[model samples]
Target: MTRCRLCGSEAMASVVDLGATPPCESFLAADQLDQPEPAYPLHLRVCTDCWLAQIPPLITPEETFKEYAYFSSYSTSWVEHARTFVDDAAARLDLGTGAFVVEVASNDGYLLKHVVDRGIRCLGIEPSVNVGAAARDGGVPTLTEFLSPDTGSAVRAEHGPADLVVANNVYAHIPDVVGFTEGLRALVADDGWVSIEVQHLLTLIEENQYDTIYHEHFQYYTVASAIRALASGGLALVDVELLPTHGGSIRLWARPAEVAGEPSQQVVDVLAREKAAGLQELSGYTEFSARVAKVRRDLLKFLITAAERGETVVGYGAPGKGNTLLNHCGIRPDLLAYTVDRNPYKHGRFTPGTRVPILPPERIAADKPDYVLVLPWNLRAELTEQLSFVHEWGGRLVFPIPELSIVEVAS
Candidate 1:
């Protein structure tokens, strides 16, 4: 009886099922490992009516985000990406000292810090108190609440409407697409800008990115689906830019529908591109399950081969995608050993389901593992550069998605 979250239709077709898996962000402590952990159905469905690829919420947002372990500031590439976005957006929007900028799900103020540096008025709405506290400590004013239609109206009333609203990588995470989009419409000024970045479904299906299908990501979006979700909430897509972050993502710019806004050629072209790619049809999603199964098989084969060769294979970055890949492939600690992450929060914890110990990045230099699996392959360039020293020991980097590959980095 699970209806489509966006269009409320019963005509949903199964796309790909990742099986039952734990929440990707739910890192476990050593002592907690003895206790039973619950896993829920990690399946994706495409609405035959609206063509929005989605998954039912296995766990509530309260359970997933209450004490979040993932912090946006942990990734150097992501922080730099945020800075670049702020620089470009500020310049293009002519944001000045008096302008207000608001970022939804502002994890640890990674983006708003740049806004504060420019002396522009900025506010951050983060649900997790832990991350929100970090934002406040970093000197960015943060409200520890989720962005719903109510919160958005209250924020706009209390602080005045924002000139720029940023919701990076959050559109897919929101289960109530209508509420979030409606809130977005209320948060931004009529003439202001709203930027939303979501992982593109076209890229996910094309690249065999089944690893991106975790409970935290409630839905996947095509440009057409994104338009439907936004239009229902009184917003119109005005522009879009495809980004390389998170495998492949699209940054959509929006304005209130009441405003006389015309979508840019970029928006028009991407919609056409999706249609040409057959994303407008259910047939596009039908074959994805078969592709995902092949990825799992290939990864296990590579891991088993490495183990047989007596090579020590460790992972770099215990990201959500990493958990999904590991859990889906049924990879245990025997396969990956341990993964290193820059974030200290996950340093002593274990990856959900796989139970792979998460160590510090320094462990790579000390252990000199034979191969390091770059889990967050979207940031492969950044990780490869940071761990390039692995080449000193003839170590190679492995990528698990889009088929497993051994990368030999030049020193």
Candidate 2:
């Protein structure tokens, strides 16, 4: 961390440290509970030179992604988001039967299935063995391998150059940002498009979404930094779209530098907005650590008060981000009881570091706790509607991010 991962600059400024936390997705099995668990420093720092916010590469991508527990299709809204993106991309890019599409880190073929349905050729390059197998079973042409420059060139040789390369929610995962960007450049045709969706650093700082900072996510991105990152591998940011996914995200539309003539007005406008927010300067990041501390204090206060009142407060969704919040707040099963998730893989497992049991989603309805503390608050709308049945038992949903708030959903 002495030198910035993205830029070779030694100038770094602190941006909230969550203390040492385990890899967020490393759920523990019952048998492994007695063994020693590992944790790493979960500190974020911003480069004054490049303005790319990053954590050190304490863990490798192989350790986390080889057998990933996260299956994208579990969330109905995210699947629909992927479907909508595919439809829009096909129409926008004029993708035909002969055209080719490729998605990197494509979990369970959620997005590429739409491309397959359109009779267009598509391939998914995924690193996780389990999820990649699921993608193949779902009729996607998937390669179970991480995307390096060589891997990208090999895929191109085998499947030909892709017309549209989709990389959603994965730009921040890689430690070798420049090499990964070059791999992306190798996969895409000279005239093709590359679409990437990542959580916006501007919104993250402004809205108090510090939970998204974890070892798995090596970097956070602003439009200004993102533009610089893209150019590392000869890609140009041609357009930009602000999205509400993952709390708040930016959809970066890029292409080969040769054909990427000029960026859209949207990109220009967003850059102006970022500049006004003081992201390029050190002003925006200096206060983030304090805000993050306030979040931890507020959440802990609420949970302790609930415990003292003799009211039960359980958690919903064992997402990776939730682990950060739980570990930072030092919440255990005593305060949270047990959390439930829709993913059966985690039903009998425990959250990494925090040894809270993960049970089935039905457990919430069966138990009818006084308050269901939602961990995946990014999926607020969909989860609220889905968990509204709790209202039948006079129960409510509590969201812990961007300040704690409780909602009484209509049954």
lDDT top scorer: 2
- How much lDDT does each candidate structure score? 0.91, 0.95
lDDT of 1 by residue, 1-411 (tens): 279988899998888878899999999999999999989988888898899888888788888887999899988889999999999998999999999999999989999999999999999999998999999999999999889999999999999999999999889888899999999988999888899999999899999988898999999999899999999889988999999998999999888887837889998899999998888887677788998999888889988998999989999998998899999999988988999998999999999998999999999999999999999988878888898899999999998788878999988
| Runs of candidate 2 exceeding 4 Å displacement | none
Model 1: weakest 10-residue lDDT segment is 254-263
Best by TM-score: 2
Residue 169 shift from truth in candidate 1, angstroms: 0.9
Clashing pairs in 1: none
State the local distance difference test value for candidate 1. Answer: 0.91
Q: Candidate 2's residue-wise lDDT over 204-247, tens digit each? A: 99999999999999999999999999999999999999999999
Query: What's the TM-score of each model vs. the native?
Result: 0.98, 0.99
- Model 1 TM-score, all chains together: 0.98
